[model samples]
Target chain A: MPFVTFLDYAGVAVFAATGALAASRKELDIIGFLFLASVTGIGGGTFRDLILGIPVFWVINRDYVWICASVAVLVFLTAHRFESRYKLLLWLDAVGISAFSVMGAAKGLVVTGSVSVAIITGMLTATFGGILRDLLAGEPSVLLRPEIYVTATLIGAAVYTGADIAGLAPLLASILGFVAAFIVRGGALRFGWTFPAYKGRPGRHPDDIP
Target chain B: MPFVTFLDYAGVAVFAATGALAASRKELDIIGFLFLASVTGIGGGTFRDLILGIPVFWVINRDYVWICASVAVLVFLTAHRFESRYKLLLWLDAVGISAFSVMGAAKGLVVTGSVSVAIITGMLTATFGGILRDLLAGEPSVLLRPEIYVTATLIGAAVYTGADIAGLAPLLASILGFVAAFIVRGGALRFGWTFPAYKGRPGRHPDDIP
Candidate 1:
């Protein structure tokens, strides 16, 4: 349980770093960086906890906020040195999604005892943060992209939920889930893997519809 | 209490109608309309309940989802007949924000007993649904629009919280809050009221920095 907690914090920190980097790109102030980082770090877990009808993870414990703030400040000061902050962000996000997806699934399984909800919570926890980050920052949303982002999280979540339901040890199940997510996301980053974009057929004219 | 519940359902229906209309503008199918409507209807309250550490209302009742779905279907069938769906959407949104802001503040006060939190929850409840709808529908977010949206919600929430704290009757306080929100939003819609947007200074060039 302590180890899982560590993974959660690690995931938060990595996500916060990405958020700060995003703010840096936008030339947002320190306060903006802190706000973005904190939201991106905790937003996913908050959504998952809410859906599970549990106390929000950050409300009871101030540590998560501090961690996000610290990561924000750190990234704010150091991000200018990086030649390719976008690449760094993608890698960090992959790590975050890997850790968070498994942890979210575990928490969902514990709370709901439903495999479907567990997998969904995992996907929500992994992707909602980035989605919020993009929306708030006025950047193009990750969901709009054709890349395999949520798909990676979904696969990892399903794997973890399946493993736990099948009586696999918790730690082993987590590792398998994390590796699966990371591999898929990493492949997308490295080789530009993507699902085919949806192409809607032309709509009938209103006059022709009748 | 029953009256407040009625207000909540009414607010949800109005919000869902706007969401479905947005889908119509985008030429989305019925399923897309349903998805957008449901999210726009319950998203804010869901956020409120989660933040308050209470069970999500829709998860417990299911009636909220039914309301959203039903509204979506109605809007899908009837929206094309409207001459200016955007105008109707704006007016309905105003009504929604008015009712939801007061109700959200009332819920927050009852649960947390914090005036500031109550006001914040009210604003979140009023605006978050619209934000989610715009994000999902790939439309320009209302938050990005300079019109006095959240400001109106804030005023309404503060008024309700102040009235409740000052020993005003619940029904009277809610009416005052709702009226305040609607008037402000109505003014914005009629007159195009807006707050001045932020304009950041040019950053120091890295190479020129000592």
Candidate 2:
């Protein structure tokens, strides 16, 4: 439990830094940096908790907020040192999503005892915060892209939940899930791997059909 | 409770219709319409519930899902009859936001006994679904516009919670809250009222400072 918890904090810190970087790019104030960081850090877990009808994790534990705030402040102070802010955001986001998806799946399984819900929770945990961050920045969301972001989370979550269900220890299952998600996402980041866009002829517009 | 419940249902129905309309504009399938409708109908309340660490209203009661689905189906079948899709969306959204805001403030007050939290809950309930709906449809959110949307919700929520804190009966406070929100929002819709955008020089860019 301690090991997984450590990973969760690490992931949240990285996620918070990415959010703060985004805020800096937008020329937002320190308050904006903190807001974006906190939301990006906990938004996915919050969504998972809400959908699964459990207590929100952050409200139950204030440590997450503190960690996010600290990370945001650090990012705010050190942003100018980054050589390539975009690359940092991408890599950090990849690692954060990898860890968060596994954690989300583990919690979902514990709470709901349903594989499908766990998988959905994992995907949401990985992607929803980034989606919200993009929305806040008025940028196109990763969900709208051809990149295999959500797919990576799905694969990792499925692997972790399946391994746990098959009697592997929780820590080992988490590690396996994290590694799998990180590999796929990291590969995509490095190689521009993506899902193929729809190639078929467009359907008649709904207005035309009506 | 009955009156509040009725208002909740009405707000959900209107919100669902707006979501279905967004799906239609995207040329999404029936499943898309259902997904968008359900999310838009319950998303805001869900946010409020999560923030307040309370049970989500829809999870506790399944009727909300049914109502959203029914509204989506109706919208899907009858969308072509509307004289102007955008106008219908705007008017329905206005009504939905007004009702949802008041309901959110009332519930927040009941649950937390904090006027500030209640006001925040109200604003979130009024605006979050629309924000998410725009995100799903890949459009600029209403929050980014210089319209009087969130302002109206804030005004209404503040009035409701303030009135409640002033010892008004719950029902009377709610009526006053609802009427106050609806009138402000409706006036904005009718007269194009908007908050003035920032007219002063922008602050120094963060990068420009030492």
TM-score of 1: 0.61
Share of native interface contacts present in candidate 1: 0.08
lDDT (Cα, tens digit) per residue for candidate 1, span B1-210:
565788899999999999999999999999999999999999999989879888899999999999999999999999999999888988999999998999899998898787766876788799889988888988887655556676788788999899999998888888888899899989988998765422333233323423
Best by lDDT: 1
Q: Least accurate stretch of 10 residues (summed lDDT) in model 1 chain A?
A: A26-35
List, in order, the clash count of every candidate structure. Answer: 0, 0
lDDT of each: 0.84, 0.81
DockQ per model, Cα: 0.10, 0.10
Give residue A73's error in model 1 in angstroms.
14
Q: Which residue ranges in model 2 land beyond 4 Å of their true spot?
A: A195-210, B1-46, B50-210
TM-score of chain B of 2: 0.92
lDDT of 1 at A17: 90
Candidate 1 overall lDDT versus native: 0.84
